[model samples]
Target: MKFKNRRNECVTTSDGREIWASRSVTVVVCIVLVCEDQPYILVNQRGTGVPDCQGLWNLPCGYLDYDETTTEAAMREVWEECGVNSLELLQGADCEFFSAPWDISSTPHDARQNVTIHHGLHAHVDRLPAVSNAHNEPNETADIRWLPLAQADTLEFAFNHRARIAKYLSHLERVAWIRY
Candidate 1:
């Protein structure tokens, strides 16, 4: 029953067994849009000072705020990192927040030497936003682009983002099959 708190201090129980604290909880948002009859995912290049992923591509993501839900955090990350207000321009008839069908672990290793809980979210939009509309925050996002979902594997992604994209693709395939 003993566990480590946010400060990494152990909360002792009678048994005194230690449980690791989850220091990082993040929501990764995959914003999909149809361009020229193809699906593209919004991605960003990590800016300088971004721990392990600096200069590498990644899905728009950020640590969850204490007052936000995972879904809310996902939308916020998209807007902050990609400058696209997904919730307002949302137009997918099948639009919903879905995770991979497989048992993907929520807990993953962080470069900062902390336990991380990652929540993957997918949202399909009817149109693409102007690339110029996006803004960059210092030391967080360097560049933004709409990468083809099929080509996601071709790029080097920070952390487990590649796997997260694969999970989204899997969900799309499942949905396609379910339509029949």
Candidate 2:
């Protein structure tokens, strides 16, 4: 089914089912490393040239590229924004844990022209890379920092990343409880 018209802005199939057009898909990767017996997550501040959220902190994330899988896109974003190579550091991350699509159409500060399908995943690392720099996408990312999970929860994040981080934190709590 297609959009009814430019003016109508809604579509209906012959069976009267509403159709939704997904504008784009974005992959968000939360890289976690354990240091000093505490878990820290990688975060980046948006640089000046970013379309929005300049100077605001967010998880390593970006739009899914045309010819890349979700995992590939996530890896690329992590490298570009956090200077970490997931392929080398990830300690058997279960990518499927956070593969579900989240419809962020109604979220505040979200784009209204297109629906955003947010896919998130957590990459647990045993150690941090010596140089975690945002060199590839210099304009899109400003500073890279690793914050303790508890401290990260207190900071405001851009692009609804706080929700994604909360989900990861909840999962961590569940896993810890299960292990106990």
Candidate 3:
């Protein structure tokens, strides 16, 4: 099925199952930082009061508000969660879509089906922020830190962030020849 302006579309699986497009799409932005030739990612730990994935580390991310572009939402989330106001989108880092309820069940009895659009971003900063909570939502984020890419796999991450980070790192490696 297709909607006007193509806002939504339906897909049919080989098994003869049809899937409807999600009504909500969230944008997950991975902010990359390089220091002394080593790469790092800005991540936040979900607070205990958070509704989901409490205590798990994840990239600075948030849902796209009504009428807000992905770029705007990414920048806003980074600033609010990490206090980093200067960021640039990585070249060739296009958005990726991931479906929720991996089972691909047509009947979602709980949370509405969601599609997460991931974006990669880069920023140069002299130092990391000492304190977070800039957005004043403690339950959403407990703490923020810069984690070395090599050590990212050591931490428990929320959602599919670990895979997303790996994808971003692969992108960086592929485009290493390009300057800025």
Each model's TM-score, in the order given? 0.72, 0.69, 0.68
**Which candidate comes out best when scored by TM-score?**
1
lDDT of 3 by residue, 1-180 (tens): 864433467899999998876566666776666667666778888887678888899887777797887667766777777776533333322322222111121223345445566666554445544546767466778888888777898999987689878776666556553122
Model 1 bad stretches (over 4 Å):
1-22, 98-104, 108-126, 132-135, 176-180
> Roughly what TM-score does model 1 have, to 2 decimal places?
0.72
In the range 1-180, model 2's lDDT, one tens digit per residue, is 985434434677899998764555667776666655676778888888788889889988888787887677777888888787767664465442334433244332334333344444344455656546636555877778888777876776897788777766666556543110
Better of 2 and 3 by TM-score: 2
Question: Candidate 1 lDDT, tens digit per residue, 60-140?
Answer: 877879887766777677877888776564544254453321223444344444333343334445567765324556667
Residue pairs of candidate 3 with colliding backbone atoms:
none
> What lDDT is obtained when candidate 3 is compared to the true structure?
0.65
Model 3 root-mean-square deviation: 9.8
Question: What's model 1's lDDT at 123?
Answer: 45
What is the TM-score of candidate 2?
0.69
Order the numbered candidates by TM-score, best leading.
1, 2, 3
In model 1, the Cα lDDT at residue 99 comes to 32
The candidate with the higher lDDT, 2 or 3, is 2
Q: Which window of 10 residues has the lowest lDDT sum in candidate 1?
A: 98-107
lDDT for 21 (candidate 1): 55
